[model samples]
Target: MNKLPPDPAPATRLDRSQRSGPTIRDVARAAGVSIGTVSKALNNAGTLKQETRERVAEAARALGFRPNDLAQALHRGQSFTVGLISNDSFGRFTMPILEGLESVLHDERIAVFMCNATDDPEREREHLEQLMGKRVDGLVFTARRADRRPSVGVNLGDLPTVFVFSQSDDPRSFCLLPDDEGGAYLGARHLVATGGRRIAHVTGPERFEAVRLRRDGYRRALAEAGLDWRDDFFLPGEWSEQWGRQAVDILFSSTAAAPDSILAGNDQIARGILDALRDRGLNVPGQVGVVGFDNWGVMVEAARPRLTSIDMNLSTLGQEAGRRILRMIGGEHFSGVERLPCTLMVRESCGAQAKTLFQEARST
Candidate 1:
């Protein structure tokens, strides 16, 4: 009697065909409606009875069904995706720009596809083609250097495009760049104000547009302050720490009056100058002041006395580019280059507050 009644097979067991997760058809079946009706109800597209819409929604919730974004985008004729092409493989400049762009576009539910071209024209062309094939709504082009660059071989057609830290060969294309000249002036003026009369400029190669622009700014600042420009005061070389060190050596060797202040091209070069100064036992901001560009946190903070540098506001440039691209996509057009202003980040290197510290120390 105990073993007499074996349990019957469970009636709730799904068949092989029904083992998969729910689909629109399953939702429709569960809601006692057609697939088309279920789609319209779920998407809230076509008009439907209130009761039917509620029923479809409930069925979808019970089934844990989510609409396919790809399909929805295709139906709407917009991918809602943007491509970011960068030649800055190291991400020294591009990363901040990308962060700003992403921050702005994320609020609008837009996605970004980033591609590093590594300064290779062919690879850039390939990425552009692939993004085009993916039906990206727009593109943002950026580079490590903010110079006018040649076409990447893609026509770009009607796709909205924005250039950041770079420019297109076509004059009609829109671009965003930092005010390098302004940044240089700020650094030079700061040094001069802090009692650095005999100022020197140590920078990258003369071929770079940045070098020329910054030099011009430095000269303008000196002229405005009534400081005479000397041929031996400018040292143009590589964008390296070693170059900075060497430039300092050559500067002191070639001149009877040494520079009381040095304006470096970037943080790295500034660090190099600091090293040379330390080796010579010259006190930073006491005997000489230093100013660097880019305000790269890593290099600036690592220096013994810290660095005072120009902040290019790269993220701001990126945000502006993002806004402009969205506008372009929205049928509003803009052309020509736009330059964002740079801000001075005061720190120990330039000695803006050193005089007060010295006076306080003496009093104490």
Candidate 2:
């Protein structure tokens, strides 16, 4: 009789032949509320009494109900996803822009899909089509350099698109670019402030728009400082370390007075100049102050004296683009190219006095 202990009641079981587990209906039934109420409670939508929301939430937990994302998206009429297309296969510039976009998008609970076209029109077309097929809510286009590029040839009808670090030929498109002219002006002014009167600008080919804009900015700063402008002071060549070294050699060989300060086009060129200066037993900052563009951390930090350079504020550019795209997606209109400002990163290469000034200004 003790062993018998009464026959145990049969356990309740779900029908295995049908869909398994609890649905929204199950949660509603358990909570003694309507299905719509359960949905609003679970999604934190609509106005509901606290008691009812708590009851529905508890019931959902007890029944283990999970809402289907696709179904929810269909109900809301928005996928909450975006696509990022870039021709920068190496990801040097693209990564930072993506980071900035993600940082802003994360708070909004949006998702991003990324594709690299590798500077190939065919690949770009394929990726664009794939993204369109997936029904991305919006698109962001970017490139390795901040330049004007031809269209990607995708018919983006009514899709909210923003271009970053590049420009589209379309006049009505929203494009965000760094202010290269402002950045160059900052670098040149810093050198002049530190008592560098005879300044030289060694930069990449003149064919690049960035080079031309930066050179213009450099001249503007020198003119503002009342320094004499010399045509021989500007050296345009390839954007490489070898070019930097050769430019230095050529400058010294010429009868023109040796430049007191050298403004390099990019960090690579700056590094090369630093090396050449060291080999010639010239003291950086003391003998010849140096500044560079791009403020690329890898080359700047690795230089003997950390290189002072101009930062394009690419992350901020991406953030601005993100905000603009979000507004456009929300039916707000925006057009024309927006130019973001740049800042000079003062380091040892610019001389101690300049670094001190930069630090003081930053602190204030």
Per-model TM-score, in order, reads 0.88, 0.83
| Candidate 1 TM-score, true structure as reference | 0.88
Report the C-alpha displacement of residue 202, candidate 2, in angstroms: 1.0
Q: Of the candidates shown, which would achieve the greatest TM-score relative to the real structure?
A: 1
Lowest summed lDDT across 10 adjacent residues in model 1 is found at 355-364
lDDT of 2: 0.85
Clashing residue pairs in candidate 2 are none
Task: Judging by lDDT against the true structure, name the best candidate.
Answer: 1
Q: Candidate 2 residues 237-284, lDDT tens each?
A: 988999989888987777869999999988888888898888888899
